[model samples]
Target: MIDISASPTSTTLVVSGDLDLAERDQFPEVTARVTGLRRQLVVIDMCRVTFMDSTGAAFLISLADSSRNRGGAAVLRGADARDLFVLEVCGALELFRIDRDHRCDDVPDAVEEPSIV
Candidate 1:
């Protein structure tokens, strides 16, 4: 099960859940939803994710690329040791900007209001 929530203030997408092959079907929809968003910073919360595979890694890479093409940033959060291992093994770690802070409680409070340039 995957849950995606967006912070209006920060324009960040907080995603939590298992992103293994079972949830691969939902990846396109998820990517579409984020791609349609006009936000500049997309922070994906992956803390709740229990497992991942090569397919999941690919999905993340695609999302990151799309975000970049649109002049936005896609960041991965809550990457536990196991998650990091998976990404390293898949040789896709360079494709993502992984957050190593492990600080999930401050996301809401740290969110800054959206701004226009």
Candidate 2:
């Protein structure tokens, strides 16, 4: 599941549950909505994510790449070692700004209703 919140300058994607091939069908739509925001900052809050596979890493990479291509940035907040490892193995760890200091308790209510995919 993912909950998206946006401000004029940034968009936050609060991710939870499992992120793997099972969730691939939802990736495109989520990607389009997020990228369409055109915010300068994209924050991916992954503290609640229990598992992530290569497909998840690919989705994250795509979001980061899209943000960078538009002169923006993508931030990964609260990613655990397992999630980090997946990104690392995929050679996409450097694509995002890792925010170790951010906490899930810091998330605000979604500006847009939470979308379960």
lDDT leader = 2
The per-residue C-alpha lDDT of model 2 at residue 19 equals 89
In candidate 1, position 33 carries an lDDT of 80
Model 1 lDDT per residue over 1-117, tens place: 555556663345555556678878888988888777756677777755657788887887787788778787777776666666677787766666666655656444333212211
Provide the lDDT at 21 for model 1. 82
Candidate 2's C-alpha runs over 4 A off are 105-117
Give each model's whole-structure lDDT.
Answer: 0.67, 0.85
TM-score of each: 0.74, 0.87
Top candidate when judged by TM-score against the true structure: 2
Q: For candidate 1, what's the RMSD?
A: 7.6
lDDT of prediction 1: 0.67
The local lDDT score (0 to 100) that residue 56 gets in candidate 2 is 90
Clash count per candidate: 0, 0
